[model samples]
Target: MFKSGLAALIIVLLANAEAQFGVGPPFGVGPQFGVGPPFGSRPPAGFGLPSLHGDGFPGPHPRPHPFPNPRPLPPPRPLRPPRPLPPQPPQFSSLRLCTTTQLEQDKCLYALDIAGNNSIDLKLECVQTDSFDDCLQAVQTKEADLVVADEHEYLKARSADLVPLLYAHETLTSYYIAVAPKNITLLELSNATLDVNAMDERAFHAAALFNLHRGHDLCDQAAEGDVTIQIIDSADYDPTDDELLICADGSVLYAGDYDYSECNIDAGLELGIFAPRPYDTNRSFTRLLQNVFDTLINSLGQESEVWNFFSDFQGTSDVIFKNDTSGFSLIPVNRNGVTEQKFTSLHCDQVSLDH
Candidate 1:
């Protein structure tokens, strides 16, 4: 029994010595017991460890993936084109002018044609009336939009609610000078014979000044005194050196040598283009008139006989505007008033009369 035990102990020591001496399973055979490889040996295929040479037996090492399975980004949304903007409305479609006579209406139509040819964007139409009062009524009732007339005429109708938009002259003052041998005062001419050209438009304007100086109404001179006022044609009337010549400021008799600052009667009035209060409030309408006036004035020297802005039409005198008008100037806003006092209060020098 002791000899058999001794042999069994020898067999167990031999197995332990083989493991400690770097000896293991035979070639091409896996370890029967769970044991690790030697220090210098490579791990078998299909193991978790990476291979040192070439591709590993299982497969190439997968690139480190931040996400194991990622979804592809959706196709970039197509850029939406910007939306289109809407159209804007016009400031004004058209402008209408008021006229008193058929000849005046014809002149307005000619002015419209001239505006169209000159590229002025204003659409002007004319409304004819029986008389100047009827024209004012048409404007007040909105049947007409504007009127070109003497400022005094407009002042007579304060209830018409009209406003001056532009002036046809810088200074509308027409000087009435009395020429009487340079010796007699204007008051002394009460009993003297006063000669005036009947055909002249200024002859009537001088009547007021004559009445002012003489301190009596010349129209009813027989009731006041024997102030013989003779109205004769300009060509036939020849004044003697002793007679009185109450003529306009720029009359040919003065030879441009007259100083009207003294011995003169100034009628401070103007020819203006006027409109209703509502039309005056529209800045666009004001701009349109300024453009139209500037265009017409610029075309004055040009040779076009079809239209004349400042001349007589169809044998009529001062059809739409005064024939003596040189140019136009814009009046200050809100300056139009019911009384002549308001107009006389304006400082003509300070006002911006520019187009």
Candidate 2:
């Protein structure tokens, strides 16, 4: 009875232990605890703890670690250099021109306006004075750079140590024609009375030519002339059959049957822009003036619609330029082909009589 009771007690204790654990092989019988495989035998599925290899399956699901390995970063890019600055414009000199009259001052201002509108690189300033002589003095003292003057004034400018830099080619026909009877000749009029209506530059030029022909300086003074000369201001004088008219030649004049070309004088005269004698040696300023002249000539047609350079203002016959001026010429009076032939006969000091 005692042995039976003890056996039943032992069986009850074994059942309780099995329930707490699992019905698998003994702990160290088939595969050692936590070992990879059996010694020389293939291991069963899920025989050990969960692994990092191949899906980590047949065991408990894998729990990710608290921290993971980070990926490598790429290399940084190099920095670029800064940009450069832009260039600047050059400096230029200013040109000053002298004006005697109010009309001339206005014309110079108008020219400045035109140059500004066209973007021309001209820095022109107008210096106004009381008289034309004052203008010449201003140019001499460096108060002004240039002045516009006529042929008569050009001679005066030369006496003041100024030189002609540019000249206007007069559009009008400039000839001093001597008209007389058809039978009259130039040499036969040496002692005969010749009529000049005005004591002007034309008369002086005619007297110069007559004195050259008469082989004597008989008509140096404009009003004082030889017996061959006569002023037509007298009312007693009438148009005689042999009366000679020394007048300006033009298409309107009717010199019928008279060979006027036989005793004609080419008044190679025009307005000139005079500057100080030192300007003739300034190459840069000369180039600048030439460039300005070229720009003016090229823009004439366009500028005429806005402002005419050759047009008169305020009842004036000629303003800045002569009304009859066609264009500007760089060639000097003595070197110019158009005037060289006629200037040879004038007996001027500057002119070469040869060729």
Candidate 3:
């Protein structure tokens, strides 16, 4: 045991000595870890096979070969001096100017850089479609040099860098309802029946006005009983009070289909259309319709030609938008409306700031 102990001590000391000189396993001496090359000198000879020669020259250092003819850059594109961008394109033919309605037709037609009438190039061939956004895309991509559109459209054109020339329809020609069905009655207020069938929100408002104007006064004297005239909303209307084509007593149902011809009205039927009277004290219905109609048509520039387009659309020829000629000029030049449903019915010409 004593001899074994001596051998173990000597073995440990020798391992520590070897570790100090880095001649043993790396971790045999922790403190010796940082003891390395003092200067930029490499490892002493025989540490490992020399990757480099003892001579100043590098061992197997890569050498350069003779310049094997450098490839030329093809003569610098022949110095063409820009060529003036091809005159900014002389009228981009086959390009389309997409816009809608009477108002935005001009914005899609030209670059703002060249919007002046003097500089405007009408030579540019343009096919007009119905979306202002589409028109702007064409111009932005240099596809269409110009886009002619409504005033509102030009205001919204994406490229502010473009120029716009204002072309306006001096007069606004809108439409109104003269005798739509809804304007015939208070809708649900009274027991009176109307001869017509359909109408709009404005017509509904007129119906309220008609009833209010007719009753609340001397006209009320006609119905001294429990019958009273009150304006009711369309949603509140009761079906029983809404008898279509009610023939009253002494009504001229047989007055014939055409009132111009002969027809005798039954005197006791309790339902009939009143005759057109000159005084028309109860002509509140017609008056209400007239006011709405005037506002709508006059708003649309109630001139005869414009008026005819609205109410005279027999649609005898073209298959475009339907001709709703109820006595108004219905020119299609349709643009987008606030809601898609309100396109024709609610679309209108708005005020614009022209430059």
- Compose the digit string of candidate 3's lDDT tens values, residues 97-116: 34444333442233222323
Candidate achieving the largest lDDT: 2
Give me the runs in candidate 3 sitting further than 4 Å from their true place.
Answer: 1-96, 99-130, 158-160, 172-355
Deviation (Å) of 142 in candidate 1: 2.3
Q: Per-residue error at 117 for model 1, in Å?
A: 4.3
Candidate numbers, best TM-score first, in rank order: 2, 1, 3
Query: In lDDT terms, how accurate is model 2?
Result: 0.59
The lDDT, on a scale of 0 to 1, for candidate 3 is 0.33
Q: Cα lDDT for residue 48, model 3? A: 37
Whose TM-score is greatest here?
A: 2
Off by over 4 Å in 2: 1-92, 118-123, 185-187, 220-263, 301-303, 333-355
Residue-by-residue lDDT tens digits, candidate 1, 1-355: 8989988887786576555533544433544434666533555543434454445353366677899799999999999999988654336556678888888888888777776877655457889998878988888887877787664465544557787888776333334455555344444456656666534544443544454445554344433323455443333444465555554332324334444443243344567788877666677878877776776666641234545577676777667777766777875322111135533222122222210
lDDT of residue 271 for candidate 3: 9
- Give the residue spans of candidate 1 off by over 4 A: 1-90, 117-122, 170-176, 182-201, 217-268, 300-307, 331-355
TM-score of each: 0.52, 0.54, 0.20
As a TM-score, model 1 comes out at 0.52
Per-prediction tally of clashes = 0, 0, 52
